[model samples]
Target: MPDALETMKTLIEEINKHNYAYYTLDQPSLTDAEYDALYDKLVQLEAETGTVLPYSPTQRVGGELLKGFEPHRHLARLWSLDKAQNHDDLMAWHTRAQKLVNDYNTQHPDDPLPPLSFVVELKFDGLTLNLTYDRGELVQAATRGNGVVGEGILANVKTIRSVPLRIPYTDGIIEVQGEGIMNLSVLVAYNATAAEPLKNARNAAAGALRNLNPKVTAERKLNAYFYNIGYADSLQFQNHQEMVEFLRDNQFKISPFVKFVDSIDAVEEELEKLVAMRNTLDFLIDGLVVKITDMRTREVLGYTDKFPRWAVAYKFEAEEAVTTLLDVSWNVGRTGKVTPLARVEAVDIGGVTVQNCTLNNMDDIERKNLKFGLGSLVYIRRSNDVIPEILGKVTEEADGSEIVPPAVCPSCGHDLEKKGPHLFCTNKVGCRPQLVGRIAHFASRDAMDIETFSEKTAEQLYDSLDVRDPSDLYYLTFDDLIKLERFGTKKAENLIAAFEKSKQPDLASFLYALGIPNTGKTTTKELAEHYRSLEKLMQAEPEELITLPDIGGIVAESIVGFFRDPAMQRSIERLLAAGIQPVSEEAPAIVDESSPFFGKTVVLTGTLTIMGRDEAAKKLEKLGAKVTGSVSKKTDIVIAGENAGSKLTKAQELGIRIIDNEEELQQLLGDV
Candidate 1:
């Protein structure tokens, strides 16, 4: 019999060629049964010989454990939507938007009005990946890491069967955003032989995407459903939904669950049907994504730093997993801060089997007072891939023993001291876990965004480069990285290039990347705005910090404490010593009040010549009006634009006067 390694090598090459033919060319030379037999043989060989390559087909579902991902800067920001949990929240959002448009029409009586309409779609539960295509050919793929940055997983993404190597459209550079989903049937089929089964399609997709082997990614049958063309200068579409249809016509795999409705009632009915059928379908869908239909409307609605004002995601409840808490352990960090972690019996949650979850701190452990030490019943929930959090303690008899914080550091024998909820280990310089985690965070998405710096890479760098602080990243040479395992000359060069790019980031982004407690992206923005410079921020007093909006007392205190720390202060100084330029905030836009439509309440009824009803409302808003939803006496002016709807009849019956088009509104504002 051939040796296991030799058998695997042969099977891998065969399977890879067949996969390329089946997925890329849509022409399979082998039959389904024949393919299965070959795959089974490869699996059996791997099992018998214990020799598996990262790029092998068997590794596509997932691979060996990942230390962490290398960070890459996003061409455009990946903003998460502020979720609408229920009907009331959705209604409230609509009402608030209505008030803005209504106020505009009321003040500007010369503008035409049209009925407001909303477009809604499904929100798929899967890994959010951004694809950039240059001249219709796929270039790179990235995970949505921290909205502004992500991990580059091009190798794995290239293997997805549904993801086209080249889009049909060849006008200019295009950036498409969508969900990478693993079908339900494929997950079930793959899990049939596993000792543990996957929990959900979304998780399976996530795990598959992160797999090291392209062959493994291929077998998972991962598919892409393009939702929106994030950036395409050459594209022209009247509405967002129309854009999807355009992409579909261009041969891109577009989302299947999309519908247009004239009334809110129709939307509700569609949503109900979707929710009922979602579980029975071949994919996983967590919620509904709703947006204004018109493209012009979308442009006018603009966006916050995080989400588009015109769009909202109605999300469902988080999935739960029940397991046994086998044991509890505490570990101390470099700063001597101790955190409790729950060791649980493996139980599946959201398509991933989780065996452990962090208890966060001593306060969390005390609050739960968990009994499942040896075999207590426990519950887990996965939020992103950090860990399953212990929601509650179920039974005491099955509960393991009472886990307590150790007086000494778990990694080092040095003593621990309690400060607030955390127990910190006094031995700062030598703590291995702290060294690894701290270095990783410094190279994280919010920090320097080093694209090729994985946890394994960090470990390799630590022993060789002797990196102790954030500044050490700037000193890494290409030659230094090339020596590491899996780091080739080209890969090392890419890593060095990313590090160079991060040297000149905005001040807000730089501060947020610092990983300080209570100081995240939003707060970092505030600090950057208030101080305008790193030097000024560093010198600011606690009283000054407390004065800023959203800078709460606790956050203010944390900021002050962080600055006071000698270690943190030294790190900041080291970063400044490096040639990093923290950008200053530009002056805020001055809202002019002398506009003709200022304070008016506008209610649109139909479509207009220049823009859609929603788009017209937005223009009215720019002129300073409170747009409303329903027609009532509170309405100041009703713009009866083209294709007037029920709101127009109501306006006419109420004797609320209307204009003809956006031109009249503009002329009344004295622009014409």
Candidate 2:
């Protein structure tokens, strides 16, 4: 066993490393629960052993405030916004702009309304950066740095996986301006695990961008969305929307919320829609930025000293709305945590109707002094899009009484237990909601993708065929499926076909379908790749698992928990018996010395036409070349297929040469 001092020292180092990854780099090495557990363990060990290190992660935020940045003037000066504080002010601003447009049109009605169209983009609250490229290769990158002279951060920016080091756009020379944002998911997950949680996405993003260590910035997983063509010669976009599309086509991540509007009324309507749907998006957006779409119109309107005359941000009003509270309901999610949901009479707030909002925890209820009794007035507001929060009591309850935690889960009536701030229903193996959710998730498009097994069918299968879980689906007979309501011979056959089809799913898809808590598709794929087989993954030690990127105590624990359950183990056995084959890494092909690629280990990803991936592997094997599925140090060459994802980039990052077509692959084969 490790000594107390050694253990504390190890934990401090680990946590410090994690902090650098999260706060500085934006990539979290641990899940929320895992990080919390680690922090708690460090705290406990420190208290017990009294051997705290001076540089302990528990003591301070990992990053240092930058001393200064050398300013560089932008080709096109970047400007900040002047806010229209309220809706009335926004309306007044709009009215003034409309009058100016009308006066211009009145003077020239024959000019086709001055071609006035507008594009609305979300105002992302994050750091700004400008990137420059020469002949498709990224040459320089800089922070906005007071919108004048900025720090040259090409080396640091190159480390960001999403930011293309070489511009994918075919254009000769271009300058693009964008926001580097910390993903809301990344922010939420990091905050959940931090001892000192982040205040908001903007702060998290800002902190990550300014870190002195480039490696720290690299890990932050900071994503950039290009919003402007800062300066581009010999390239002309007809409109702002076209410019946005052009940027997106060139592999730059652009805002999906952007929309083109024909008139001010349409812009207003779109803004209202965006506000209503804000709670559904997974990013922090302050408001809607409406920019005149026509390039000529934009040129005509030009810029004010510090703001765009042709563009304005329509800000959402601060949370302050009264709605009658109905009864509070407790919902048990797939993870077993019971979330408190408040059902309220639908009330319009900032031109959007909100009837129900989430109460994050019991602490939130206490904070709001929320009561369950009907006819209680409550205030609701969403801080960003993380959750719809209850602000406070709007009025003393006509029948005011504090709401108590539900003794049982509202979904399945299972007894609840308190776990920190959360209320959980410990019906892990017995819960029907979890069963449905898991089953549905397994057959989702990203998983095994059994399209025939609809949710309703799964529910019917559960009830009529006594198939309560994912394992039971494999045991289902054609007769059992045929007997169900709306089930015909064709439909039953389709279900069987889909089930049979799933039997050959790759290891990544199979693991993803298992619905293990904290094990997302990416992590599942990583696990599958690392282990190359289900048996190895099932038997993986926690120490081994914790070493994987993005996998930590919670995921390891969850994986162990899944394997530990006798029923789950039996389910795996049954699925295997039903002919399911998890994919494994293709072994290196034996190349004869005479073959062109005799010593080459060629990797392939995405769709291939000359042969299927498996068939291509066989052919390459026959040719005396090694064929693998993923790119790594051993990969001598990467033969890219259509719609190839990040693996191509990985290959490039490793300095491996890439080939595009089967003809090029053939040429490589001939090179021997």
Candidate 3:
């Protein structure tokens, strides 16, 4: 009989050759039965020898199920790319790259750098996998967890047919990063047999890779396409495109749509083509990743604490789908606007289930000729994967009933007032939905932060105890809540205690909790900063309001109009009378005028080590700095943390000063 080691070596070579032919070349050299027989013989030989090489084909059978995933420190950090939503954002990024190259050339003088180029590839909507190969042998595989550390998933990764157990080159360590994706067709087929159907291909891939059972991952048949070389000791490439070419040459799958572009206009043209081709792809793709081509330029540009400064992801437009319009329900918002919500037959769009979508106003409904009935099909679009909106009607049926505006408010049965495109309830005090929404917003974590206070509790209080408004929550006794279902003496006491504890919120939190139209968290913070007190804000005119940063004419008008309302004034008076005294603590005096961040417009991005982003922003604001979200020409400085994306790139392009670590940030803020 042949020696076990020789037999094992023969089996490994044969099986690896077969895998390469079948998976890499899409051609099978052996029948299924023959492959299985060889695989079984290899497993038997490994057991008989009592020795298993790291790259042995039999190891693909997987080991005993793990109790839990073991944490692993990655060979190299995996940073996330910053994203761009529109063509303008992409153009801004391109402009920044050009400027960086020009700056480098100017600094060197003698050895001027070449003009910048970019490589664009499809941004696969799937889980990231980092594969490490030591001396041509697959050693470890991990998922991208917080960039620095990850969970080891070597067993699951080996099950992927396209991933070679051993490569041709026997050299130093090489770490290749790719996205693990399941084809949409394969996902659908798998879901049919699966006990719990997966919602989307991306989720399915993620679930399979993370599963404790390697057999499950193998059964799913997950595939991968390598995009980057995270670490390689011996390998060298001039640019990202060259690295991709090398990966492709090594029998690794790569994105077919990869393109090398010279200008921003060319990139935009390619993006348009991608949008048209995106739906036809076998896998899901949210966007395209654009990277600087030259490795030397990338080194010069460097990285923020969290993301590389050289690349940005340009996201595709929102997806639209057609579904049966089952019914229309008019709901009242905190602003008393009665908006129609279309209850549709559940349909999958971009892997998300869409059942209910918003119809902006009565005018929007009329414009779209949206009829109420079961037969009519409505078009729904998820804008930026956040807002679900009814685009228009796909199919109109004459038998379908026409949707008409309600003469009376649905929640309060009061007369509805027609104001331009919207239908208003105007019953601010009595409207149940409005009251419930407002109360819920007030007790939310971002607001007064009344722990355990929920919308259900707010509804129960409204129906049972006549707790009509936010101020009425303070008046609730234990007896009042005890009468409601699921409410006992202890629960009622706890709720009342929570309400009492929520009597004093910060000025910004209180302002946001009021549910003022067009006033988001950022706007509220800006308003609080500019006015310092509610009394001062209420006294400010629209002209004065428009002068603050990010406060436009429309937003300014909305703020002024909200404060001017008689009912809002009464609500504020009642809240104060009920002992809700919001306070604005005085900001600390600036230590020195020499501080770089003093009175500057700064933007903070990514995960900071010293403190939370919010805490840092608050501290910066206290030091007379205005912190904004986006990076623009107006931006004076950008304080970046780990994984900071497009904003950092844009800041670099605009020649804005960037502070990386918390220590550097503190130095600029005069906190050191």
Candidate 4:
């Protein structure tokens, strides 16, 4: 029993250390298989000894479902920060802070204040969460509701792997405040099967925490980063920066891009840097938080009615504009999804003229209470400085008119279908928008690589010729293309040549060009790698697809559904009948033993001057080298180009050999 207990203790400590390294540090010493072995051993020992530690890895498994959320009062008020929109407002706030500090220094002449330095941190656009730990164990987690009272969400918060269930410190009480955010990549993956896809990461995190099922929250993969000490009974720090350092020392995740600056000018510069780096971050950050570094100064500054006076949030100017709603146009995508596009009076937002914005679907229109009227004003936002969308109705004239979805497809005049939150056109063959979109996608550079095909060409072919589907492109004669606008003898010959080239696209590109729902470039590559041929992929069952790596239930269902469709099957047969054949992606041939890059993993980063990134990767892979997306210890070489980012930094850190240009890469590959 003593031996078992000791083994369990060691395993628990080692697993927790690995967890900290993987989650908090973004570095892992142990492989996933190694970690799993240790975890399995610990579970077995704990089961035999009947001694389950509170911080055991088993406790992280989410299975509980709460009946309802209970209200809890916070120990310390989670005050909201005052916000400044522009540099002038920030300077005004700085002036006020300096005056208050000068007054305090004058009153206490013996203990005069030093020049104020500010700690600037990114203001994450997420849900504010307060966590309370008792005796080193996480006891309660709650939302920041009304600053004083909030709903308990301990079960949901515990499922977030980044939030430590138990810490090393056995302090009396430690209450920390932070933001709960959902990664953009996780959100995109989750939305593949979600009935009602979340609009943004902020709302997704908020909804996940407030969910009644903890398992659902766990599946969403929410992450948290502690930023402030709300109430700690046994901890003290001289300044906010020191408190942040203490949080980091305790294995808590904090913002990586924090800096201390002595003046408002420096703070402004940091804010500019933060804004420039915003799109590069995994999570959303709308602004920067400037807080006075001195704890003594903060004590003197105190609070206003709703916010702390010592700290201010400098928010970036919103990429939004109010525009007049003129009309709504429903467009059909390659998937037959009929999405509504709002035609608005032309207004400039962030230097771009925004005439049309996405309404998403009927559910979105209803949720925003959007009505079709000439006098109605709508608020549109360009999220992430891209993707223009109508946020909500700003002001609506008292018109009793409402925007209703069309019962028939606008292009083909066929009945439309509604599934979940989306409306779809059932006319797969005749719908102009759907056909145009599919043809355009099929001929895209990343798909079938038909270089001569364009949207205008597709439309003209659809209108004038007997072309109805992608298979029809192969049957088009040179005479047919010569009759089209701007199509002389040379252009017609080039079009025929491009069509011939597209008949034998690589397997991955052909799969992607088929317009399978929920399948992106990565999924297509995985499909090609697993099945190797189109016939095998088409015959794959959902059960078999789900067994493949990264192919979840939703993706498997989508793949099976696409192949099972009678129309899709018929289209495939027609393509085969028209002599369209796709070349399978075969394994790279083994080069001579003298080749330096043989069987080695290589990573390429930055903009290659000689060739595109994809072309470079393909070239390296063809030389018996495994091309990887990231740099690690296993990476044999990193081919870096101009303006390389984190991969280059990681390569340098790992002491991996880095080749500067294509010439160096060729030299290593023995192609020089």
Q: Each candidate: what lDDT?
A: 0.71, 0.71, 0.82, 0.82
Please give, for residues 63-135, the per-residue lDDT of candidate 3 as tens digits. 7776555667888799988779997778766765676677678879898766777888999988899998899
Candidate 1 overall lDDT versus native: 0.71
lDDT of 1 by residue, 203-271 (tens): 778887887665667667787777877767676787776787767665566666787776566766877
Model 1 scores worst on lDDT over the 10 consecutive residues at 59-68
If scored against the real structure, what TM-score would every candidate get?
Answer: 0.68, 0.44, 0.60, 0.51
Q: Sort the predicted structures by TM-score, highest score first.
A: 1, 3, 4, 2
Q: Kindly report which residue stretches of model 3 are placed more than 4 angstroms away from their true locations once superposed.
A: 61-63, 70-75, 84-88, 134-136, 146-150, 168-172, 188-199, 233-236, 249-251, 261-280, 304-307, 327-343, 346-375, 383-388, 392-591, 594-672
Q: For residue 649, what is the lDDT in candidate 2?
A: 88
The candidate 4 region of ten consecutive residues with least summed lDDT is: 395-404
> How many collisions per candidate?
59, 14, 3, 0
Write one digit per residue (lDDT tens) for candidate 2, span 1-672: 258888886876676566655653457788989999999998898787766564455443233333333345676667776566456656655664555566567766778345467788888767788988787767777888657666666655655545655445655778788888877788667767678766666766767676766656655667777789978876888788788778766657678788887887787888888888986776667777877787866665455447766778776667567777776777777668888888778775532347778788888777676754456787878543344666877765446545678888777788888877888888877887767777777787678878546677767776788776677787788988888887778778878877887878888888999887777887887687668888888888888887654566887988988887887888889888878887776644455667766656787775454444666666676676656555667678787875577999898899988888877776655532
Choose 1 or 2, whichever is better by TM-score. 1
State the lDDT of candidate 4 residue by residue for 1-672, as single tens digits: 988888887888899899889988889989999999999999888878888877676666666777666767899999988888888879878887787778678888999777899999988877889999899888899999778888899888888878888887786898889999988778889889899877678778989899989888888889888899999888888897799888888788899888999998999889888888777888877678999998888877777557777899887776888887788888888789988888888886533457878888888887787854445888888754355888888754445257878888877888988988998997888888889889889898789878657898888998899577888888889988899887788778888988887788789998999999998898898688667889999999999987554567898999999999998898889888877787886776665645677677788886454444667776676666767666766688888875677999999999999888677776665642
Cα deviation at 209, candidate 3, in Å, is 2.1
